[model samples]
Target: MESLVGLVVCSLLLAVQGLYSPSDDVVELNASNFNREVMQSDSLWLIEFYAPWCGHCQRLTPDWKKAATALKGVVKVGAVDADQHKSLGGQYGIRGFPTIKIFGANKNKPEDYQGGRTSQAIVEAALSGVRSLVKDRMAGKTGGSDHGWQSGGGGSGSKKDVVELTDDNFDQLVLDGEEVWLVEFFAPWCGHCKNLEPEWAAAATDIREQTKGKVRLGAVDATVHQGLSSRYGVRGFPTIKIFRKGEEPEDYSGGRSRSDIVSRALDLYSDNSPPPELLEIISEDTLKKTCEDYQLCIIAVLPHILDTGAAGRNGYLEVMMKMAEKYKKKMWGWLWTEAGAQMELESALGIGGFGYPAMAAINARKMKFALLKGSFSETGIHEFLRDLSMGRGSTATVGGGALPKIYTVQPWDGKDGELPTEDDIDLSDVELDDLERDEL
Candidate 1:
């Protein structure tokens, strides 16, 4: 029996090791050799910028190592402790604790790692990046200078609004500046850069006026600024990076049109605002006004619990606030009401028939709504909204084809229920004498 128990213990230990073991093949990179090991290497590299104290990094550590072990030879997996190697982290514009970057053939322009944290997901993304690198290389040798990615290989000349950045001025103007910058890294002979010239100039002008200089747009001549080009890993003709004051730069992977750039800039510039207001749908006026004000409105019908008092309402509101913050970039409106408080709205949404913590997104103009079928927590709400943004979430006509009549209730004062002060007891007259007699 003792031998059997020992055997079971050993098996459990092995299971734990299987799940958490670090890969011996995962290269540990630091400031000292980052350039030699990653930027100049012939192999494709996926590097994770991590901090020892980050909870997410800790959770991802095992999976990252497992992915490294799986992709040992085909691709190189590496990690950098951003906390310890601050200079290297800053150079890459790593603002977050655990950012992953994919370095392909064009070692200068690494793609952001935005996939799932699972080993399988990481491996898939790495393979995809490698494939893209291979395709770009196979496209041709000197074609980048002749045809580029677009028609005109030469620029249409410089514009005034778009700041001209060179290696000498880039650091002073962008990397070390107080303002946020959206910079385009481009080769002057590249056709795509030439095409982007007009759009970029227009966006710069609009962004400057709208943001009042809080966000600026700049351009780098990759051919001239060899140092900056190599440092940023700019393998492509036109690459964009967003540099916020004192933060690591983020790759701008959004659409390249003028409107898209302006929209994304506004989103980033408004990053300091409070999470979109999570208002209570007290009356018809409030509901109508909120829906009209924002392009999309997320409404939640939460539990009404006077027994647990305002604490329950506050807890639900907290969840909404967090979700709102996570999606602040979308500029969506967040509103909530107690379950059963807005009966007409609830019926329209088909909520009370289900349960508390039900959520729906409304495009008031379209008179369409999408129900949230998943958990109402942060991740679930994020997934739902992401689908909606991508035009994937299914929508139905709002019941009644109009906004529901919402009645007002006492807004939560955000405090626990109070006990009424009792009148001074008659025991004030008799309690003292009884206690003295009993003691005697």
Candidate 2:
């Protein structure tokens, strides 16, 4: 009887262990249903391409489930056991365990999640995806086609800013176009084309407004317009081409995300505007003006030439500029002053005792500031900024400390010793060394 009881107890324990399940919020996906459920779905999907035996995937499971729960209706979260669904994993080029890919409107072109592995990071990414979905839907509902008539071309119908191109109108609007053009060549039956419709439409609205209608976004139905498709050598489902007034049609090889497309369009626009200026903290008045900008301001207190000279300071500035370029999406302001130039600012930020090349991010409205504790390299600064953006950085109140008194100094020209003023540089009477003698 005792032996029989022991056997029953062991069986019960095994059953309990086998019954452990993942969160119901996360949909279990496989190779058979991947196309029907993911490729054809209208909702945005955040799928985890993970392996069961991977320790990293196991660790990420909890956070993934939590994010799914939080974004329950806003976004759809799914996971595939890559070890079992090898075909599906191989289809999407998944070579790593626990790879997270965000399938926005464009299902074929998913964006990789490279942010932190924390629950907050997952939630933030999901929210961004949700925003994209809503924006795309808005474009579909309110958008109109350029064909001057209502014709349903693909999934979710036509869009407002996406001009429908044809064999007849392609030359007049695209070839002889004065403004820059971004055209998408697609087919109705193609799954990838269906996915790209929403993203393309949403990006079109933004690009149109941003470029003030100078850059037009259009689409071509490759099947309906066979002449134009054959002429462009369009063999793919969704081939994007750019057309400028005097340039050949250039292929757009960038990512299909709304942000990526918008960024690339702005680059093509090339308005020749200067990047955000790095202000010099010349006086208390300048500090007041800088702090009033509502956005987070990064303040750098660096060594004077007497300590590390201009080379060292310029090198630090270069690092700051690189970081600024990388994170231009955040719209942050950069400012700097010599170590001793702003004594009160240094004291408030505690950078004077921390040595040269110290950095701190300030929120003037909240009267709180967070100082950088790591190296001043690009990666270090990126991590710091990332933490602050995520609200993870430790901050302190101003505590009634007096504002810093700043000394007036010329802007850095990335040169050693005294910089030449504007009046010192001359262009008059300078002969062109590369001039060629031409007979009239």
Candidate 3:
């Protein structure tokens, strides 16, 4: 009996290890085939909603891939990048990182499990939640979809819950001046945006509850924040985005849920301080060590040029300063040390261009980083510095022009919700008489 028991134990251990193999694990879903492949899939659907900048999403990818390949005949696994399909992510109210949604014809209700970025926990989700749903279907009880999985979240659409809001004091009322301004990208004519006003107000109000006047909430007419609406890629009705202190005014273009917006804001803005570390350059010796240790260096130009005499700069700077203070350990801010002459060092770092007024982001010494170009103002610089001190400089949007490429820190980002705002638009793109006549 003792010899037989030992054999059984070894066999079970092998099965667990076998489950970690990573062959044929993940699939990409786009606008054309989402419904056919997922919503209407014959087998169960386990979709991971994530953003590339989110570190948590990065770590989860490998573990999830392992789990996905292991499931094989048991379940179908897929992924949805919220940064690409803001609309889809919005539909799901996915606020943070590594949101795993399971779809099947059962009644599991897809409960959100905040296991973060752990390999075992993610795999276990399938073994416990998904597999259990499958078992229940084998029994007599019914009502799950033919491809029924489950739905998570309680609030969908809008409720009567409202807040007092208007255009006059809107910016001050909503934006708490975390120093950087995160505003909604919206057009007045959109029904979805209009319906979101109440919720948006409620979201801003909720932010003030704990922030104690640290951050500010506001919105802009995508009809006017310029080609900015296009650069940021506002393909949908309501989009929200984060404006680094001293950065240009870019509204959200990615399709994301209200809850996601609110939750992300609370998390990102939870600590309001300007970033000062970004303004100082690293010593030649320290720079070598940093390169060796991190293998990558990401630099942000920020809004040093455009925002100087502009409207949005002051607010953005405060945020950056706060970030600087927080990440003093691994961050350096490289701006033009001399104003009149071109900064050769910054230019060499960027290849024939000055790294002025842009976010220079690098990774693992892979030598790929982005120049977040926009305007900047002096006061905006002050505010931007304030936020950086607190150590947070990130925002995400999806479902339009590709999202800003950034890295994630954790395997699972946290959660919360956001409210949508309406933009007042000038119908210059269309003719009034023609609009009334109806081309159709």
Best-matching candidate per lDDT: 1
Better of 2 and 3 by TM-score: 2
Query: What is the C-alpha lDDT profile of model 2 across 318-362, one tens digit per residue?
Result: 888887776665556788887777777777776665677899988
For model 1, the superposed segments whose C-alpha errors exceed 4 Å read 1-179, 184-196, 205-214, 219-241, 248-274, 283-285, 378-395, 408-410, 418-440
TM-score of candidate 1 against the unseen true structure: 0.46
lDDT of 1 by residue, 1-440 (tens): 12354345434423331212243667888755665687547788999988664568879988998899999889999988776665456456676768999877655446798899999999999898778767777885311212122223353322455787887888898988878889899876788787776657656766776667888888887877889989988889899998877787889998765556776777777784557878887778889988887768999987766545777777777878988888887678889887778888888866664577789999886677878878878888889888877555456667899998878788867777577688875666678879899999
> Please, what is the TM-score per model?
0.46, 0.45, 0.32
Question: lDDT at 427 for candidate 2?
Answer: 46
Which candidate gets the maximum TM-score versus the true structure?
1
Candidate 3 residue runs with Cα over 4 Å from true position: 1-23, 106-109, 145-440
True-structure RMSD for candidate 3: 26.2
Q: Output the lDDT of residue 346, model 1.
A: 81
lDDT of each: 0.75, 0.72, 0.48
Each candidate: RMSD: 17.7, 18.8, 26.2
- Name the lDDT value of residue 228 in candidate 1: 91
- 2 against 3, candidate with superior lDDT: 2
